[model samples]
Target chain A: MVESSPPTRLDALLDQLATDLEPVKPLDDRPTALVLAGLFAAAVALVLAWLGPRPGLLGEDVQPMFMLRSGTLAVLAVVCVAAVVAQAHPGVGRNSQGWKVAAAMAALFPLVGAVVAFTDPAHARAMMMMPTGWQCLRMSLMTGTLCAVPMVLHLRRGAPVAPERAGLLVGLASGSLGALAYNLHCPFDSVVYIGLWYGVAIAVAAVAGRLVVPRLIRW
Target chain B: MTSDEATLARLMRESQGGNAQAYRQLLGLAAPLLQRWFRRKVAPHELDDLVQDTLLAVHQRRASWDPARPFLPWLAAIARYRWVDRLRRSALRNHDALFDDISVESGESALIGRLGCDRLLALLPAGQAAAIRAMKIDGLSVTEAAAQLGQSESMVKVNVHRGLKKLAAMVDEDA
Candidate 1:
């Protein structure tokens, strides 16, 4: 049998590795998963923003419960979209040397905004406009967490995934989850704008993923 | 009556002048460091081959060894390049392994290296915990790790970094 060869499995592996192979070369997905779960909160911010200012709180804090700020909403959306694209294609666009750039950019947006908010909460608050700051942060955190979950799984899988498809899946899943959770805080009296619109955006992205994922997958 | 330094210098000059004995002595002196370096990097199976390659390169390019320069650094440089070449050549298949047979310093005589284990153990997830133990306790290379876990080399490396980062962060956080 082939198993009975003089070279043991490790011997063969080492022989191949020494003669030919080569070397070249994510984060922990669990915390990212829980954080991802917060995209559900992306719901409350987007919906309330467009529905004219319904400031509801997640907790009992009735101090104008405008947690998911519009700025955060946009950040979450962009991150979600990036995640979707990454998921769809997996490793496709990565070796381009610009992946670190994209990753830095994706990671930078929130930190910059957070710093901006810290510098001048009043002006920052004014520019942020929507009473959705907390919600939006939660959304970004959630979507990041959510998209990161599957991405972690993908990394752990170690089978090559199409980078673009990976991104798409990340974005769509994060978006949808953000919409659904955020919607729970929706006030029945006013129309839930984000709950409706963002939900549709995420759903559309998911369907697009369906199309893209198929194309991305090897036959 | 020549000092080791003079003898070493003479040997270097002689090796450069194509003295096979001088070349052999230079290689004899350099072998330990190269072997150790390669041993840390590759599977047990690949370690000798790589070390041989490193020595062969050193011999082939004997002129590159500047007499004014300290020898170890030059040899280390050779080892590093050889290591990089090995990594690049195996990029596709090895990309999935985690540690890639790099021997951890704690591996030998690690049974006595009890200082970091308790704290390190506190930080690791299951797989990383095991890896640190194997590297520290059992003294296996990253390739042996793949064999142990039935995973890829890149995956092993990834896990090691993640585990290491976590361990480092835990130490920092604790501090």
Candidate 2:
């Protein structure tokens, strides 16, 4: 009788894995998209239930600035969420540069606001005198929190190569979603108000995500 | 994608569907690739363990792979993540072992140990080299090294740890 050599450790591990293996559904981008959509719908619904929409929201002559602000926030939220979702699938040629472009586009809001504020003294004074600006900041952050929690939970399912980047994206996504929801009820449409308060709120969320998210999703 | 990658991707897709034979074959191919990838990044003693850890990671995160994408990059990313994780773990271990136990005795053997380290020390920052030389080669205690170097005791320890880590990295690169 011929005797065979012992099975090596790797062989043993492989056999064990194969024995324990079960059918698994491949991860797709759709589930993440659906999650984000649901969250947005919920946030919008909550806003409508808790605080009524700004007067003339459904009117024919709705403010152009309001549309622009909401549209920018919507785009930012979608782009950031997409970037975060892409982290789950690791690939060499795959890149998530869309979020950066979206972020830059979003930056235009604050930049134009800053330019307007500096060039026009009256606008600057108007921004400074608005007492409800802090309320806008608080409300935006609060709304962002609604999105950030579930988004982080969803992110935990995948392995992100750069945890810090994923975290930052999650924060930005949530903050934008929050800002978008808050925009429905926010009566102030000044470029300065949107730029300073909304921008700060999103920046704070991104920083917080950078600090906090990596710790939760490391591995 | 290369033919090899196409085959692997097909195998992966089959494995995801509970095809044990395909899954086993995929892992069989993956093990050697992981070994070669890890060989350059880790010591010989750690090579097998790193390969196995990466294989286990690949198994656990298999679902993370998007079918439409090429397979090799996804595998490479997972391997890179493991390599980094191993480096971090070793650094932490070294940090914890910093002040465990040391005898301040000098002899010919110690001199022999110091012979080749001058080259290594030269590659480090001046402060780090000085701290490493005082504490490691000369067999000085942390306090003694700090007093001799005119740095704080904590700074001396920090420099020695950092210097040792750099030396390890240099050796790794050379290997």
Best by DockQ: 2
In Å, residue A70's CA in model 2 sits off its true spot by 1.3
Model 1 global lDDT (CA atoms, 0 to 1):
0.45
Question: Chain B alone, model 2: TM-score?
Answer: 0.55
* A1-219: candidate 2 lDDT, tens digit per residue: 011457888898998999989988987777667866887788788777887889889899799999999899999998898788887776644655788899999999889889999989888788877877777677777878877876676667776766777888888998898889989988888888888888988999899888899899877
| Native contacts retained, all candidates in order | 0.00, 0.59
**TM-score against truth, every candidate:** 0.28, 0.76
Q: Candidate 1, residue A87: CA error in Å?
A: 40
Docking class of 2: acceptable
lDDT of 1 by residue, A1-219 (tens): 112457553344334333432211112234444444453344455545644343444446543313443344445555554443333212111222233344344334345555656766775546445455345435533543444454445333322223333435554555545544454444421113333334344545455554544343321
lDDT digits (tens) for residues B37-68 of candidate 1? 45534555566777777666554444445555
What candidate 1 gets wrong by more than 4 Å, as runs, is: A1-219, B1-7, B94-175
Model 2 sits at a Cα RMSD from the real structure of 9.3
Candidate 2, residues B62-138: lDDT per residue as tens digits? 88888888887788777766765665465444321133232323433432232223444677999998886675545
